[model samples]
Target: MSAPADATASRVPAGPMARFFRRLGEGRDNSLGLLAILIVLVVVLSFVSPYFLTATNLLNIGRGIAIVGIVAVGETIVIIAGGFDLSVGSVMAASGMIAGFLVTHGAPLPAAFAAALAVGALVGFINGAIISYARINPLIATLATLAIIRGLGYVISGGRELVISDEAFLTFGVGQVFGVPYIVILLVATFAVFAWLMPRTLFGRYAYAIGSSAKAAQRAGVPVSRWRIVYYVTCGLLSALAGLVFVARTGNAQPSAALGIELDVITAVILGGTSLTGGRGRLWGTFIGLLLLGVVNNGLILVGVPAFWQQVVKGTILLVAVLYDELRRNRVEEA
Candidate 1:
């Protein structure tokens, strides 16, 4: 009787509580996989080029990725809400031009910066309103805005580059904090804020819930329209910030600056495992994704890969990431 009881106890499956904790550990392991990739890339690149492992080269790569990483955080938010934005690059150009023109006209940096950010928010508001209120698809709306904004950028600059002469503004671009680039610090701060918002806040959970299933979210009273608007607004504000950073780094704002940055931002977000179909993503994942791309680009230069070929490689990587995202989504649905 004692043997039978012992055997029966052993045969029983582990409790749901144990299984739950095990699954949580597995999820953590999945998260670590991203870090592992970053480590491997760093190791491989260091082997490929002696210059690649230098402190300056590493800092340069971080600075190089800052703009895209910042922009991609906003993109990650928008994408998690089940929408796509094609106007971010154009918005960056236009907003920076607004600031540049202001400085050209003798406006103070603070006032000009405020105006530029306000314009970006307004553009984002229009996008959100049109998508939610007018019921237009995000892709179509933003695509149209992309051209309109790009044209506006050209008109504002009069097809010329506005050279910023403000020493203070330029310093924001090249400055360092505790021996680390200011731009990298800014990127880190932005990532931390968004990470907290997306995973630890009520609004953030609602955003993800709505994207996961609009009908279900509606039934749950998630206020889908309101959150969507907030998402786009945040996107716009950050895009303007990114534009300013770009201008600081380049010391000029041209109509052509950030011409294809939206694609890169989107690509990084997708490669980070954010579902384009909506509702799933982590800010940290997007952070790593941007860094990965930055590392790749830097590695290419160190290895003497030509600029022309870099574009091709970038496109190929984007294609693969998108395809992988779609397949991953399909697998989740099937399961």
Candidate 2:
């Protein structure tokens, strides 16, 4: 009888405590796995191309990823809250044009920059309002606004590129601080703020809760609509900031600037483990995703990959990342 009871106990499933420990172990393993992959990629690239490890090349990589990373941070927030903003690229273009117009009219540098940022926030606010108040889907609302904003950009520029000739602004575009590019510094600051906001604040927790389960969050007294709007507005504000950087870097506002940027921004966010279905993502993951793409781009160039092939490579990587995320998600669900 004792032997039969022992056999029954052995066949029984693990308790919650045992399961929790297993999950914790799996989480650590997954984290280490990603870190190992990153290290291997770095090491392999350095070996394959002598220039891949150079300071100058690393700086180039940093610069390339900076804006995308910034935008991805905002995207990550909105995604975490269970929404999408397709208009971000267009907002970037519009905000840049707004700044150019202000500067051309003798507006002070600071004022022009602020005005540009305001435009971006306003656009975001509009998106949020339409989605929440009007009860429209986020994707549809943002897509509509995207078209409208892009059209407005063309009208504002009279179908021309507004050449920015401001020396001060140009300085910011090319400036550096403490051996790091200004763009990189800006990206770091943005991420730091977001990193704190998402994990430590009421708004952040509510945002994630809402994304994870809107109905449940609502019942729990979370302000779903209000926080959703805030996320989109924040995204808009960041996109506008990216626009300023673009104008500063390029010294021109073309209606076509940042074309298809939304896709790239989303790609980075998704690659970083942010789910499009919402509720699961990390700002750090988005940062890593941006770096992964940035490194691939820079490394490809160093290896003499054709410019067109670069696009193909990026697209392929994005697809693979998405697939991997889906598989991982399904596995988690099954477990």
Candidate 3:
């Protein structure tokens, strides 16, 4: 008689690289492929443009996507934990406007900035509560918040762009630490911390557990509602951080800031190889994927691609990433 299939599979021995490839096939990692693609992209771009591989251009690419990278970090977390935050772009705009409005009204800079982050977290908490407790679909819930927050942004800014001139605040956008831009530093640090948390901490493990099988996790005594909310809150806070950074970099808070950024964030996460079905993905993949995105956009501009055509290219990449993930996963797991 043959042994049970599951038991037999459990006894199979595999080397480290073998295990990684197996998991890669299971939608657990895409960094290997993403890295290779990024390298090829860089090489090709370098051939087309003499400035593409220059120090200035490399740093420019890093700075160009720094804010998006920060937001994508948070989105990567929520996606891995089996949720989405479509409101991120709105949250960023709202938070930036909140800080801008407060600072302009004679409030202390620190206080105003803190308030922005607080509001971001509040919005996130609302999102989590709606999904985990109200049992609403995560997509629908966040999509609603996205509009609400953006409306509030318009109301807060009176539909005008607020110019910010505070030198301290502006320094983060302009200053460099040991020759690297502050925004890039923030991006790298954010990714590093979250990357560590996802694999080395209980919080990260719980995220995977919940994402992989919420029902099973609940049966094993995990607090599903609470943790799901935590994930959104974390995402919200980071979204807020990204917003502040955007305003600082651009030197103004526009009610319309971060418009259409949701696509960039989600596309970068998907391109990084995270499954829309959840319970899979890694930050390293997202980081590389983001660089790939930055390179493509920058390269196109250097080669004289029109703005509308550039947008078309972005949309195509996003579509392909989603299709690839869907084909690999085959089915979405129940929450």
Q: Tens digit of lDDT per residue, candidate 3, span 1-335?
A: 35698788778898888887786666556788778688999899989999999999999999999989999998988988899889999999999998888877788889988999998899999999999999999999999999998997788667999888888888978899888999999999999999999999978999888889999999999999999999999999999999999988999988899999999999999999888878898998999989999999999999999999999999999999999888777733321
Candidate 1 Cα deviation (angstroms), residue 156? 2.8
The list of candidate 3 runs beyond 4 A from truth reads: 1-28, 331-335
Per-candidate clashes, comma-separated:
0, 0, 0
- CA RMSD per model (angstroms): 4.3, 4.3, 4.5
Clashing pairs in 1: none
For candidate 2, lDDT tens digit of each residue in 48-167? 998889988999898888777878888899999999999999999999999988998899999999999999999999999999899999999999999999998888678899888999
lDDT of 1: 0.86
Q: List the residue pairs that clash in candidate 3.
A: none
Q: State each model's CA lDDT, in order.
A: 0.86, 0.86, 0.90
Among these predicted structures, which one has the highest TM-score? Answer: 3
Q: Indicate the residue-level lDDT of 12 in model 3.
A: 84
Find the candidate with the highest lDDT and give its number.
3
TM-scores for all candidates: the values are 0.90, 0.90, 0.91
Tell me the lDDT of candidate 3: 0.90
